[model samples]
Target chain A: MPEQLADTVDPANWTCPAPLRDQPVVVMGHGGGGALSAELMEQVFAPAYGNAVLTGLADSAVLELGSARLAFSTDSYVVRPLFFPGGSLGDLAVNGTVNDLAMSGATPAYLSAAFILEEGVELTVVDRIARAMGAAAEAAGVTVATGDTKVVETGHGDGVYVTTAGVGLVPDGVDIRPQRARPGDAVIVSGPIGLHGVAIMSVREGLEFGVEVSSDTAPLADLVAAVLAVTPDVHVLRDPTRGGLAASLNEIARASGTGVRLRERAIPVPDAVANACGFLGLDPLYVANEGRLVAFVPPAAAEEILAAMRAHPQGGGAALIGECVAEHPGMVVVSTGLGGTRVVDLPLGEQLPRIC
Target chain B: MPEQLADTVDPANWTCPAPLRDQPVVVMGHGGGGALSAELMEQVFAPAYGNAVLTGLADSAVLELGSARLAFSTDSYVVRPLFFPGGSLGDLAVNGTVNDLAMSGATPAYLSAAFILEEGVELTVVDRIARAMGAAAEAAGVTVATGDTKVVETGHGDGVYVTTAGVGLVPDGVDIRPQRARPGDAVIVSGPIGLHGVAIMSVREGLEFGVEVSSDTAPLADLVAAVLAVTPDVHVLRDPTRGGLAASLNEIARASGTGVRLRERAIPVPDAVANACGFLGLDPLYVANEGRLVAFVPPAAAEEILAAMRAHPQGGGAALIGECVAEHPGMVVVSTGLGGTRVVDLPLGEQLPRIC
Candidate 1:
């Protein structure tokens, strides 16, 4: 389903509403660990890319290919409603770390979680968080090996902030990095995008859309493992979380030092999500997807990988949307069904703050 | 400088804090990641005491130690003022992990840092944090091989939070754990305590204490190496952080299933810290420390370890404060200079919120 590169650049360019230079300060919704934060990462920060280590959004990334035995990665999760939709801060903490390790093509084994709770917060919440963390650890097949907790006075902090550091073992010969993308590489998405952000946003705004949109906040270790098994040559693997598809594609292009051409017709968009985006005048491409991923692979083996992804419960909505190209190095261009081309730029400013 | 145990314990007359039974809810300061969080951990969590892995507060704890590898522990740090006196969140994130590895009689070789950033935060702040992290890694002689960044919207987060995980190599014939304490073991402290907590509090409360109280946060890998070189039989090693000396001792007692006795007069307390505590109704014993450690060694080799600790820059103020005891298992008793005795209990609640 990967589309061919467009012959010419389209004149209809979609300018981001808020340019990076316009905002001078951070807002409350930005720290919600949801959509707004992802936009910031997608727009301003990710363009300056080089290392393959930074491309994989794992809690802790695994490095060292030869005889060296080690994996490392770091992650910070700022989820508002510290106690939220289906989980607490602790559950997110443990899962965040474990998922990071998994994203690195490693079998997540251990984790370290740090908690920053505001003053006067209830101890019951701490206990609940701890319990959630224990449960999350069990679910992810990892251990909460070490952790630290600090308390800040109220006003200086939100309810609770958790940072989880994870480490895992990467089997030999598995080399997945962003810079590995090559021309003719097929692009595949694990599942739907922007679910987590939309879910959190819906709750926060108290706006009930006819259709349900829950946070796609589940761990992706199993899905990653299955994809790796089917085709280890999967060149680039990235989770389209923050900054959604636009940010992720731009990052992949920059990392691989190549251009990406996505087809509007091939990309799958849920009807409800599409309708919601239309109503809100929001671009689904810029939304966040916690549990989904975008993978680039050899064109011949793309179908195998796609089939493997689809077999996983989390990858039920898997689809091929684009292909890597040699033109316009470090750029992502998309062909609209209306015979128009638009450069899918990195997200700019806050979009649906606190969507996570 | 290791000190002898001051025999002063009357188990029959011991008192315990009233059991906490209350409604479950999260308080703002609980997310501060300071003293209050520690209280919750000790009172409600640590008592679970299910395994050795849960008791030791080391980073990326060594799991299956055989002839090939030895030592295992885990720890988490939630220090507020992510960027604070003498160090920023990055320094704490890296060194905290390295120190945990060192505490296990291991030479820290690798570390991983994870960040949870609130949305709307300045990319400049993140870049600074990353730069600080790189510098910290250089200072600790380690590498930040992998990382993950998750953005939460505003109102649910502070500026940033970090978690670190590390692994180290334990030398031959080294065994360090809390339960290893013996009746005649000597207790030695690396340096002055309460600086980190007090410094954070001073800045947080906007108190202009006459003297500058900067956090004494630094990497302890070198100091730990020096101490281990002298005697691998180091019975126990601990960082007197949140809940400070009191919490560390109680942890050791519970871990080793033994008792500890200390002389309050023999313990080292800087005049400024003591004064600040006096003014704030706080106890230095329960305050936090970033660049301080307590080591328990065999009485025979206590002097050697003390000398080694003193030789290091971080241990300039090293001193012997107490010793392990056979009676009153799982208890820590302190003899005041005034000839009175009191059981040093785990801190009951948050003291000096956000004092990293």
Candidate 2:
């Protein structure tokens, strides 16, 4: 109503894609951790909390505090059917956050677990989830050091939603981030992709396709540590969780002002996952992966790092997927087995919501 | 089921108290941060995690990693009516977790925020809340370094729920924990109580009590730091939230294995808060105050710490409330104005749920 406040309240000034310009309410895509998610962060959160560390927009924000470098990250798991083929929400909450820290070449040391339990949920269920979290934390070699629990009125919340925040120590001489990707860096994936997303989808839809596709949800810290031990000069590391490899590549390309070229035959996607994606009319490249990570290493150290990764159990299926290029800066292109190249665009929204 | 698996699945051995024995499902009181909340943690979480750091059950866990002493804590804010009189859920999310770290005599540094948003909530609402969080972080001199966003289906969530985890640096020689209370320690409160709870209740009930009760939701890191500057030997510092001062005092008494005697007349309760509590049939002592803190200081250092606290704007109304006693260990008693002493037991649950 006031003259001075009119400019602050103008809706036209909000930066969003043309398709999303008229949208006034949040949609599933906004939380899909994709293009819309980026828009939300760039337009709303970035301006409000104008800080340099946050501007990096890495999976985990790396900070220097009192001569110590730390990697801090947070994730909320609201997966449907708390339990799935290979993992439960509890394990996902723990391993997911631990993996986020590992993506930054940090050794995750401690985690904080906060739960929102709906009223009337069975105590036995709570116990089961808590035990699963404990087991997962132990498996990841991280501790659930502190926590808080709250109950929402029935109907206001689902069974339970768990959010985990992790703190880790980044080793000296290691500088890994999205913006560190260089033009000649080799792109490598730690293991098979799309299994985690397809596994959740199978359970949700109650469709068993003869072969069960279990989630690839495991901690990647050991694998990352192995690679770092070989060489701390690794440029960038990212766990393709929500928007999958396509989004991760796009983010890296944009951040580093470089282009990406992927070899379709070299990308590791299990047969079961491929079949499931085919049946669901989805692309494996855009499906989420809980455990796998994408790393960019200089050509000189790529062979050693890849071998180090493959030696680890979690990275047994490692593959050289792509490489950064100067041809199409900020674009990703994949050469199909048929000798044709297709542009791999970031998914606008996740095909599977709450997959993590 | 197999015989061995059946034994593992049995819930009969869960260690809940007799009063909570019949609670087959979660109740609002279980998350009230009171007796039921303590029961939930002890019965469900503690047994499952089985870790020493969690056994301490302090507001924040003090960790020694590398050469740095760190304090880590977390909380989830599901406050109703995102905007209240004095503070919104946005600021509350930031200040609440910051205060938790401060309670451990740490200088709050970095925070991670995770949001669970319901589909269809207005984007403007989210932006407003995010802006408020930015402002609050600035006021507290902490950074929202990293965050996560997830959306639940409509009707499954209430607008937006926020969870924040904070990490801070604890100075050497500062040993603050609930069990640090000594027999001769003096109890002090930073400011008035009960406004935060009543403020939420007033907004929820749509009642106008002539005077609008504003929440005392504020950051207490500076106040706690000031006291530590005066004396790092200050025994305990607690931000009375959830079940409020009564719950905090009871927790301290039990942890220290000592009795506490309170001078009811010395406890500071804002006249408006007291009037609101009286009208609503609530005890001001048991109502929440987000901004205030309770300190247990040695008899010799009490004056110096109290004076230091009073010098800070947030602790301007500081008062000496009570003293820890050797009689009737693990109990708290208050001397009433009517020449009678009354036991102050922790409430079974909060009178108001979702009061942040």
| Candidate number with greatest lDDT | 2
Cα shift from native, residue A225, model 2 (Å): 0.8
Give the alpha carbon lDDT tens digit for every residue of A331-356 in model 2. 77899999998777766667878887
Q: B14-71 in candidate 1: lDDT tens per residue?
A: 2322232343544433333233344455564454222346545433366542223523
Which candidate's TM-score is highest?
A: 2
TM-score per model for chain B alone?
0.86, 0.94
DockQ of each: 0.39, 0.69
In terms of docking quality, how is candidate 2 classified? Answer: medium
Q: What is the DockQ of candidate 2?
A: 0.69
Q: Rate the local accuracy (lDDT) of all candidates.
A: 0.67, 0.87
lDDT per residue for candidate 1 within A1-356, as digits (tens), equals 01121324321232323543366546543433333444444453333222344434433456542334455565656566666555655666666556656655778776665666666667666666677777777777776666666665556556666666666677668777777899999998887776766666666677667877766677788888998888777787777765678777876786677899999887777776777677777778877677788888899998999898888898998999999999977788889999988877655433654444
